[model samples]
Target: MPATGEKVAALGHRYAILLSTFIGLLLISNIVAVKLISAGPLIVDGGVFLFPLVYIVGDVLAEVYGWKASRRAIITGFLLSALASLTIWVVQLSPAAPGWENQDAFEAVLGFVPRIVLASLTAFFVGQLVNAWVLVRLRERTSGRFLRTRLIGSTLIGQLVDTVVFCTIAFYGEISGWDFIGYVALGYAIKCLAEVVLLPVTTRVIARVRAAEAAAIL
Candidate 1:
């Protein structure tokens, strides 16, 4: 184990990167969430599809850095997202310009439902932590041989939890029950496929980062 100061310093470096990625993911996911499209039989929402990269980045952090580091990143993302939501709510309540006829439109776009925010925070927190834990444990178990299995498999399970919980809570009254299930399943599959397709790139980046870290240690 590293000495206390060394461990703190190491964590600071790790969190700097992790936190940056976390905030980026949170902001992008929420900003683009409104765009919904159809991809064959699937309904692809911008946030649902793109948000998996957050888990991918989390996986990379956990696999290389360890679970503790990953958890900090996950929690940091959650807190930041909450902060963003709160700020948006506050702004929406503030007075608009006298000539601003678009206040309603602005509220329609930016105002978040309480249920939706709660579901998002809860699901992301649980799913990401679960993903990181599963990835790290599987890596340890397999001696790091089945990289794809760990990455994709953990993502599959994690995204399922995220999709189901978030969709159920966010759209419970807005959508039919069947439609809710369909959206959740569609989102989960899209996210899993995305992570699988990005596996090669992820592997390469992880390797480079690990090498750099090792070199710095040396």
Candidate 2:
């Protein structure tokens, strides 16, 4: 009982909010990703567009806290994503009553594609961990110099891996070969650029959070 209590306390202190945010982001992104959309000439795929923010949040957690915290976030995100997919699949497969003509369409939209599911969850888990790890290491290596560089560079690296893995997994055969690669590359670039441009604001928010945490510690 004591050990269990201690473990719970530790988890609550170390990662309650980060885990919550990660799960929230992952679940919501999966739901939104069911429908693809467009902004201008860019074809913004569902879930992919909103999912970038998870990387940013992962960065914040890692930069201010540490890799372990970020890792916890990643794991939590992965598990929740899987759970969400399972829920969708279960709900989609269950029988629908008469007068429900849209049931088939609903299932069609929400049904899980095995390859895409594996690819998405795998890519995000691995990519987010890599992003957090790189950012933390770079910060230490540079002695905290070039904050923007670390933030942007880490995100770019992570997003590239994520895009390739997800696109290849989800759309490789369904899309024309050339279009598949092009869309993945374009999506990665756009997401990375957005993160880079948001660096200053991210830095400010991180600094504030760290200060608050430090004050509490002291």
Candidate 3:
């Protein structure tokens, strides 16, 4: 059996993988968010598909690695996302080559409004932190039982914060009345529902990860 220290090192190695996936999904979600897609009667940003995965991964991190590790991952994702946005903003501002004809296209794809960027960053940071915090607290309260409850509860709260914050800041005046309410409601509902649908898969992944980490420790 490996020593406890060796096991911890192994677990940390696995964490690195989870952290990378989390950050990659986050950055990609921001980039794709430039486009809005219609799902039935609802309109939501393109990022909706991948964005919720971040929370699912976050739940795995918090449930297995604990809140501190999850917090570190969240902070890392935030800084890296901000960096990506800044880099894109700079690229968008730089003078285009005289013969270049795709500047509009480039901007259309990569350039995001400053307000939207601000809203995304702010919402992501707050929501991720809340997710980790809530999961950790619930773990403590429940003595680590009822993984489904922790996952679902934290995701519902976190996605709500993310949707409301992002929508209010990015589209408060632009979308009013029931439209605004529908937008927020749809986003939150979809995210929560996604979590519910993926619960079984998440349970399996968490179990495998925990078992692997335990074996490594032993």
Candidate 4:
């Protein structure tokens, strides 16, 4: 329940950008995730490139803006992702024009988009909330000390939950037994490692955001 005039105002510019980027990453990841790419010996979805960053951004939001703001962004991304899927479904099902010979191609690429988006939204909503809650809870417990430990711990749990939920929903029956296990296992490992590796950058971004907000108050 948000007032139309003040909805965007509530987010402000800096936090608004973070929210928009979070949603953008979700939409783009879902769109490109249709393709399963070969990264060396590993078979992964195109989303592998962007999903970790999405989580990192989530961490930033939670770390800087706290739980309420983080939850709002997560919910917004979930709803927008659903909207994107619905939009694609409508376009894909519409009658094609005479020169439009790529209907099959369109359907081929965007046909199963709804399912993937469903899985993504579900996983994102659950995973991000858990991550944000854990982060905020830890901040409460530690008085904001141990930033690295909090982030790594939350990412470890959140990514595992997200990976399992997303992979099982998106690729369970689509891939074979061993492949499914590998996909889930590797994706989880990679997401955690990616966040861990980028922890310094993420922490810096969070710190800057907090500092800027504090300066704005003066």
- Deviation of model 3 at 103, angstroms: 0.7
Candidate that beats the other on TM-score, 3 or 4, i.e. the better one? 3
How far residue 162's Cα lies from its native spot in candidate 3, in Å, is: 1.0
Q: What RMSD does each model have against the real structure?
A: 2.9, 3.9, 1.6, 4.1
> How close is every model to the real structure, measured as TM-score?
0.87, 0.87, 0.95, 0.90
Give the Cα-based TM-score of candidate 1 against the true structure: 0.87
What is the model-wide C-alpha lDDT for candidate 3?
A: 0.89
Model 2 bad stretches (over 4 Å):
1-15, 97-101
**Local distance difference test, each candidate:** 0.80, 0.80, 0.89, 0.85
Q: Which ten residues in a row have the lowest lDDT in candidate 3?
A: 1-10
Instruction: Estimate, for each residue in 1-218, the C-alpha lDDT of model 2 and write its tens digit.
Output: 23465555654564577567767877888777768787888778677655777777788899888888788778877887898889888888888888788886887788778887898898888788888989999999999888888998899888888888887887888887778878887988888887877777788978876776665454
Show the colliding residue pairs in model 2.
33-46, 33-47
In candidate 1, clashing pairs total 0
lDDT of 3 by residue, 65-184 (tens): 998898899999999999998898898899998999998999888875889999999999999999889999999999999999888999888888988999999999999999889878
Question: Top lDDT: which candidate number?
Answer: 3
lDDT of 4: 0.85
lDDT at 185, model 2: 78
Stretches of model 4 off by over 4 angstroms after superposition: 1-11, 173-179
Q: Write the per-residue lDDT of candidate 1 for residues 1-218, one digit (tens) a residue.
A: 43466655664685587669866987789777867777786666678656877877887788878889888888888888889889988989999989888879978888867887898888898889888888888988999888877888888888888888888888888888787777677777778888888999888878876776665454
Clashing residue pairs in candidate 4 are none
